[model samples]
Target: MNSIFKRTYSYWFLLPAAIIYFIIFILPTIMSFFFSMTRWTLSDWEFIGFENFITFFQEQSLSIGFKNTLIYAVVTCTLKVALGLLLGVLLTSKIRTKSYLRSVIFFPTLVSTIAVGIAFSMMMHPTQGVINTALAAIGIDGPDWLGDTRIALLSVAMVDVWKGLGFATVIYIAGILSIPAEYYEALQIDGGNSWHKFWNIIVPLSRPATNSVIILAFIGGLRSFDLVWAMTKGGPGFTTDLIASIIYKQYQGGFYGLATAGNVILFLVVTALAFPLYTYLNRKEVDL
Candidate 1:
């Protein structure tokens, strides 16, 4: 009985944090669920069943939002995994300026998302932007990055990769560095070259890092809003409309219930996609 009491007291240390979690996250989520089913103002709410949800789905740009959200998540996640691994391996190798290079690569990540978006938006301008100006100097015409319907999402995805690659590379670096030195030494004794070392050891062992990068990048891409808003506001005819952005637009239009419904849908969608993905990736990690 005394031991159990001691253990209970030990667990009490988590009470404050748990209470904070309940108030900050659990409470708001519950409120969102409730408010999502209502037509509400500051003073009162009228329950409307699932009408808000139905109207949310009936939105003209919902399809585009879903499409763009998926594409953005997939593209950014893939690029971050591949490019990050490549950079990680390179940076982990014997190089004099490795520390400086690592810092340089990570610099963009430390910048504000909105700032990066705004800066890139200006840089990607069709005519006078630095990117286009440099392209013209090289006798190439750069397309309108943010204004184009087709490539706008891709452009934003690329910027996301640029911003996120550093964190992914850092994860990979930690994974690679954690590998036993004897593994490389044994491979060398077995007449294994650098490619063998990387392929047999680094790629396989670093998969945990890859999985982390994929999951984080995918979720972040799905929830991406500020950058898109700052850059194009889901413009160019919904080319880069993401679920989060659509919710913001709804809120902006003063349809609070509809917006909340969209938020709930987004939460459900992310939960649906993320859990399966996480489970599958973790299973792969275990298999590996």
Candidate 2:
């Protein structure tokens, strides 16, 4: 009995969390799968089989939204990894104001995403925005940032990078700081320059942080809705119609079943992309 209790006691500790996870996540998720297959009106649900899924694919905006989702994820993930690594390296180096700068750089991450979107939307206004006004002062006419279909998605992506860069930097900063000082000392003793030390030490050793940032930023880009909706609302003629945004438009139009189907598709797509990428990154980490 004593031995059994010892083993069973640990299970009790997990019970609360397991229950919460089921009630909050698993339950809703299961219901969503069911809801996706029906034409639901709260009181009545008509079985529709795969009609919702088929209709979702038949949406005119589906193609554009899918393309935008991939583009946004790739662009944002790339920027976060590259810029964050550089910022982390700089911040980790010897500098008098490094602490102050770190806080300043990270300040943006603390702001609400929706608020950031609204603020940037105003600043990106073509005629009277602060960005254009500043450009005008320099005798350069700033193009319509949010209104131009060609640059709309790209513009939103840049804002996303700026918003997320700080978190990535902090991750890299922590990773770099974790390295033993002895490694740097050894490199210096061997007459190695800063470049060699960074290339040989920081880059390789920071792989774990890089992996985390890529996975996180990519997932975030794939699921991003609030900022994009708040800013462009998939505007400039469906050019920025990410999967999430398209689903939202369906929800607003009262096509709950179709929207749920879209949600299901997004869940599958994110899982498919993320799992392989995560496995690949982990394998690389193990190899290193």
Candidate 3:
């Protein structure tokens, strides 16, 4: 009777969260799958199996969006991991004003992303922006940052790294701090320098944190829309259009079914890539 009562109480505690998840996630997912197979408007939907997917793949911009999203995810993830680890090591060192510097670096992450995008758009203006002004002072010409098709996507990606690296650094700091100090002491006793300590100890022990940062940042990059939209609006000839931006454009143009199909594809891509990478990284963590 006691065991039965405990089991009943445990289920009661889980019921609310289960219901909420179903309502928020599962229901929308099911509806999206249904809608993806139809031509949907506000009040009417017609069954059109696989047409949306076919159209999506046939679109020129969709291919560009997929390619850009893959590149953005890979580049941003690599830079964030590399730069964040460097920043973590520096900030965790016995340098003065380290905490103040950390706060300053992290301040951008707390600001609204749209606001950041707008502000950066202005700053990157070729003629009147502060970046160009500073470049002029140094006798260097700054290219049209967001307006130039050649460099627009990369410019936006750099901003993303700047905004997100602080959080990644903080996660690294936490991971590094949680490691036992004795390892460093032992390394020092054996005459290991900073390079040896970092490569041999810090990197190995921080694998879990690095894994988390990579997955989160990669997903964020893959789904990035707001900043790219506000900054470039997928403009200068679709050079900066990511998959999320393309999907948003579809929705805005009243292609609800097509947009739904894109969303489902994005979901599946993230899940498929993230799960395998996550499992592989976790296994590496255990090995380490």
Candidate 4:
């Protein structure tokens, strides 16, 4: 009994954290579920069943928001994974000023999201912005980056990648450095080239880190709001309208219950997509 008590007693230390999580996250989520079904104000709420859900779906921006959200998530995740892996490999190699370069790469991530968004918004301006000014100086007519509906979401996705690339790189760097040196040495003895070392060892062993980056980047992309809001506010006519922005629009128009339903839907969409992705990625990791 004493031994069992000692073994289980360590779990008691988690009580405070668990309680906090319940209060902060779990409780609010449960309340949101209820509130989403009601027409409510600060004073009172009347349950109107799933009318909010129906109304939310009936919004003109629903399709646009849904499509843009998926595209944003997929594009950002793919770019972050590819670019981050490449940068990580390069940084982990024997290169001069690697530490300084790493710091420079990560510096953007330390800045405020809104600040980055605002700064980039101006930099990407077609006529007055530095980007086009430099382009014109070199005899190239720059396109309107943010104003062009065709590439507006892509532009934002690129900015999101820039902000997040460092984090992904750092993760991959750690993963690469954690690999045992003997594996490489053995491969060298077997006449393995850099390609063999990379394909056989680095790629397989880096699965854990790659998986973490994918899951985190994907989830962050799905929930992306502030940067998008700060940059374009889903502007250029719903080109970058994400689910979160749609929800905010609803709230702006005094559709509290409907907004709550949108929030619920966003949560559900993220949960549904993220879980399957995580599971599949984990399976890959295990298989590797």
- Per-model TM values vs. the true structure: 0.93, 0.93, 0.95, 0.91
What's the TM for model 2?
0.93
* lDDT to native, each model: 0.89, 0.92, 0.90, 0.91
Name the runs in model 3 displaced over 4 angstroms: 1-4, 7-10, 286-288
Model 4, 226-267: lDDT tens digits are: 999999999988888899998899789887887888889889
lDDT for model 1 comes to 0.89
lDDT-best of 1 and 3: 3
TM-score of 1: 0.93
- For all candidates, the clash counts are 0, 0, 0, 0
lDDT of 1 at 105: 94
Give the clashing pairs for model 3: none
Off by over 4 Å in 2: 1-10, 286-288
List the pairs of residues colliding in candidate 4: none
Q: Write the per-residue lDDT of candidate 1 for residues 52-91, one digit (tens) a residue.
A: 8777667667657877888888898889999999999999
Residue 144's C-alpha lDDT in candidate 2? 98
Strongest candidate by lDDT: 2
Give the per-residue Cα lDDT of candidate 1 at 23: 100
The residue-by-residue lDDT of candidate 2 on 1-288, one tens digit each, is 999888878778999999999999999888889999999776788989999888777766765887899999999999999999999999998898999989988999999999999999999999999999999999999999999999999999999999999999999999989888888999989999989998999999999999999999999999999889999999988999898998899889888888888888888889999999999999889333
Task: Quote the lDDT for 243 in model 1.
Answer: 87
